[model samples]
Target: KSVGLNQVILRYASDKHERIYGMGEQYSSLEHKGKRIPIITAEQGIGRGKQPVTFAFNRVFMGSGGNWHTTYTAIPHYVTSAARSVFLTNYSYAEFDFTDDETISILSTTPTNTLCGQIIGARSIPETVAAYTEYSGRMEPLPEWAYANGVILGMTGGSAKVRKVASMLRDAGVPLAGLWLQDWGGIRNTSIGIERVWWNWELDESNYPDWHALREEAAMNGTRLLTYTNPFLMDARGPKGRLYREAKEAGYMVQTVAGGVYRLGHEPGVSFGLLDLTNPAAVRWIEDVLHDMLKNTGAVGWMADFGEYLPFDCVLHSGEAPIAVHNRYPEDWAALNRRAMIRAGLGSKNEGGNGEGMFYSRSASSQTPRHTPLMWLGDQLVSWDAHDGMKSAVLGMLQGGLSGLALSHSDIGGYTATPGRHRTRELLMRWMELSALSDVVFRTHQGNRPLHNAQPWDTPELLDHLRDFARLHRALAPYRAELMRESSLTGMPLTRPLFMHYPHDVVASRVATQFLVGRDILAAPVMDRKTSRVHVYLPPGDTWLDVWTTQQAPAQPTGPRHGHGVWLTVDAPMGWPAVFIR
Candidate 1:
């Protein structure tokens, strides 16, 4: 049988029964057992639940006494079955088939010799999946400093201005851990009258004078620098241009349907193409550039941006189909960076091992948890609405199996509207409290607006408060480091959703506005102005202890502690979010 979209063919010998299980939630057992289940190969947005496809074996159509079966459960190990199995070679696309009693053969419209005649055994499925995860690479632990309060200077100011701000933060007694330098560090220099040979990522020494000394000063003050780098290479420019040409020659860059290098639409100035990480040589070329940046600039890590621009019209170096590889590119991108770090001996598992590597990615895949240790919610509005949206984003990532997240700093003092010093202070304090528990706590504000500045010194009182909060973040680094280790080893999230704790609680599923920091601390950040109190859902069982006053609230089946259901009122004067521990 030939496989097409949302369909597959399975060939089986006569006289054999197949059983299968575990494709997400099942309405009925027969839905995914002993049948050939239809699978859709497509791209899904973040927070969207698993691929929109089902698998079961109970439903099967037989031809000439040959039976086909579908199973949701991928076997624990590779087992040679009497059934012949065929699937989309790409794992990101759904795989729906079962191995029982007969040899099952799967056919795809885009069949590759690599997948033809491959025999799978039932006993090795789980190990195979686990090995695949390991093969992709395990998640790396973030640096200790990443957990502390950080200042993300928008592109509004030049490098000198950023240095001055860093100096001011230090003078204010703020224990800053990192400085996020935006696009000012580099500019694309084009050869005169030549369209090709554009040089991006070249340091602007004139603007950033004494760059080495600046990095050293920050390092001495216990702060590191994180600069931004985009994957989009300028059309025919510099090393990237050369690399692109080389890759195209070697067939290592993705190609379009017309046999042209894929062009990224957002960056129209240059014809952009993605490097195929499946190609070892392509990975090596990218790694060399990363290593050179670290060795020369004293930079710590990268703020990997723009991975969301993966076009559906590109092909992989491994000859895999384009549609299935779009979302999976970020995983491969992060993996390439991690492997580079490991190759540099920075991530060697040695005593006092300096394995500090992470990426601020905008896209993800199923095995993203194994690559990106630190990911932030995608671009969001700078408004109170964003405050509520942040909760949903965090919970969504947690449920989707991400290990760590950075709630945008706009939740703090920065807003797109007119600035209110008092209100901004309140927001900043509350946001700081919540951010202190995150894997990365970096402050950022919107750009291009005079009134939307998030500089810590917006007010003398606010500056003092910011300093205090920054110090608290530094003090919590030891505890945060322990949690980071735990998150790396276990599949637990730093910020957890309610379902993680109360899987069966119907009420918890609807409550995405709040979450637990680790397993003990619960946080509810106010997302609206003039809202003094908010309702919190408590799962049945343990009583919770208030973080501020250490007051105990008795667990009840329903009703409010004061006036609302398990409500925690914010003391506006103190300006802190309601936090509790169970």
Candidate 2:
């Protein structure tokens, strides 16, 4: 059941009795009485921390990580068998080899511990994967308007500044869908709970004069308001401090052995206490607070940020093993938030609520697609490199089984450090073109820094491009919603890596620079700065039709030209990414 830190392989009696589940939608089941199947394993990347779990009979593979971050673990693909059931787990860094005779072998960068997975009987491989998807919980369909383009004005000046930008974006004819207010609601220029902390949760009247009015205006314009709330609760004076104390006393918060509550790195050394999601009372308390916000302010939802930093030195109320539970914390956190939304009748029935509930979270764990509807790639710089990085980030996330990604719009006009009005315009135009195709597109700039200010008026031309892209995004709302619903139902990724459709193609496995938006469109983003051209690989079977030019490329006959194949070529700049549909 447990492997060491280095590569090790063990053979056990092929279990004919155990039932299996959780390999996502690619494999067949063991109960199919007709045929015998081969299970093969392969090693792809090492140390990037992706571990895959496979069910041999169903051909379904689930991936997990060795560390604390969630969203890294995913169900990749699957295969099927009739006589016996098999599964593979590459925990840390490892290689899995499947023999023609159905023998499973594994090689690892470090020794890994694996679970003895169960075997199940199903009619077919796809059915097996579907069963797993159902058991893990299906993905939630995002709101129709979520697909439209919007701006995430970073935590800059104050409420006045945010409202001003919103007004201008609308006036400029930008078809904005939402406004993302980051960290502004938590503390108002200070860290959470450092001084007079309890009051921090309430509106900072000085900065947010007439906050209710602002929310009303935003909603009237078809824009939803999203704010950031981190897990860190600072130990401070007044009701804020008292809330933490009560939560802790009621066993609603996580406790550290060092006798100090957990704290996230923020200005003025702001510290935060962790809520123990395992405790039902804690869940209720958190729900009540959020309910109040929604009922009073008409706020839409929260950007549930930062559950990735749980300390190994802390304790959970459920008495679960910390190391085993660390990476699972995000799942618990998301579930708690989702539960709150449901209890307040603000979310979907699947999430145990009524309305269209959405939570944009940072970290995630297994079955995240079932709970958290949207996730932005974690913070990155606002520059060309950041722009290029978004493609890779998207590939990684999709390969890891995410439904959709919200790469911060900061890269469009460049982050705070790089300064040039013209350069900002070009970058924003290029970035917007690609962002328009994503599930949740929002523009944001880094705040608290001189160079990263993302005020829309900073560059007029960039503003024009922003408006154009926002409109394009709004037009794509129908398609985006459909995709979200499909991903939720099928466990298929919105942004797919080449390997998902072309698993048998060798070239496809290595093509990380490009990915598919859905089954039809393929995007190869320009990753290099100042470079106007790059190579693109197309999977073998289908001829590709360029999305922009409607040009088609003939497929080669050397291998499969259907299902999964690979082809490669170079493309020239077109002010946007090279998109092709077949």
Candidate 3:
């Protein structure tokens, strides 16, 4: 019922002991049973309500550091312990209340009165997840090379720096899949980092005077080049900002309530306008721009980023209520990127692994999966803190899997940083251990401020550590390839919670922090600093083989076998994590 203008309240009966999970890409514990999750797409705040740090960051950055429920991708859907799921299709502002033990309440502010969805059921938890994904839609597989290669190293600045580092890594024998240059267009020294310019889309000739030649060289070295992009076109006025002026003159920009161009950003030259996707002309213009860029540069892919900043008060060219179109913006954005790739002859009709170029995004909702086959957990703080860092990426994959985001990864070693929160060599190595198992494409980021964080090439030990993991990841290519085939055909997530495999084992069903990679491997990455021992729960279905255990008592089967599951502690020193093959 409507409690006020454009608002409706919804409630559903729930089992008293139901353990609910899923709210796409959340940085929290796997269960949301007693939590309040706001279903809105935006920048994930710093700290994420984690403590004294959150307080300081909130006071300074005005809550941009984020809280537990703050997510780039939040869907109005969930799966419970009983193996049932449902998804709401509403795009308006909404929140999920699991505070009540026997009921789930959703309060959503929308332009309409109806809140609708479909209840999904199957024989088991995995089957139910499959059913839910089938009902929604399955994202296609990424190109085969994504799984076949080693790590995609993140770097910035200009072509000179990239070439220098790439040569160094090549000399170091680090297996290279791709190089992610987020500053291909140009760069700006911000309070955050040496981030690229917000307005420029064209390649900065000054930065990459040898662009075409570099692409050819990288390709010859078996490395694909990836760039970065977002939805906003910063409203700069001059010959340099031709696209912005042209878009405005063609009426492709979203408008203010008073009917002038709506601009956003806290600083000058940073403020920008969004392309009104509702306008077919605007959609065509941006897609064509993207298509031409990809083809001309011979770039295999790019990061299709930031679709969460659309304003609910802006006016679209199609005359639709902004509030009604808000949450669906990410879906539209992904679809547009997909169309652009397809237009450039980089799309596959059957399976997605046909060397079809791919893009990854950070925003999603109910329908965002089918279009955005690749999703990355948004920027994480450069700390080991679980609320918004390495540990949070674990939750991101577990929870994101339940929501049909089959291919997900995080910026290795984390991204965001403040004064005190910085990356350490220990943190970077430990974060890589966590990622080596869960992510589809092993990738790293230099963080918002590269000056504050440690990169893979920061130290000799870090470089050797990266090389070890890269070799291990490459060795798993055949296994991962099969996993991808399964994910593409069956909608079964590549990273999954334990309950899906050991449903009858009560203790195993609730285990967090550890997850399954496909149906055979169980990974337990250490989530804390200054720890060499990791406690792991071995599920009942199979007797596990330890991959790498050192300097500790052999793991013993302990506790009452809850369907034969038991606990074991093992040595997991730096660079070595607990991974079991079942």
Go through the candidates in order and give the C-alpha RMSD of each one to the true structure: 11.3, 9.6, 2.8
- Which should have the higher TM-score, number 2 or number 3? 3
Report the C-alpha lDDT of model 2 over 282-379, residue by residue, as the tens digit: 77787676666556655566677666655566777676545545555667777767766676677766545655556676565545555776665443
- Give the alpha carbon lDDT tens digit for every residue of 46-149 in model 1: 11221111111112211111112211111111111122222233433333444344554444333222232233332332232233333233444566566654
For model 2 the local lDDT of residue 515 reads 74
Taken over the whole model, the C-alpha lDDT of each candidate is 0.48, 0.51, 0.81
Task: List the candidate 3 regions with Cα displacement exceeding 4 Å.
Answer: 1-5, 191-194, 237-239, 349-354, 549-564
What's the lDDT for residue 15 in model 3?
A: 90
For model 2, give the 10-residue run with minimal summed lDDT.
39-48
> Pick by TM-score: which candidate is best?
3
Could you arrange the candidates by lDDT from highest to lowest? 3, 2, 1
Candidate 2 global TM-score: 0.73
Q: What value does the lDDT take at residue 35 in candidate 3? A: 89
TM-score of each: 0.69, 0.73, 0.94
Q: Give the worst 10-residue stretch by lDDT in candidate 1.
A: 50-59
Candidate 1 Cα RMSD (Å) = 11.3
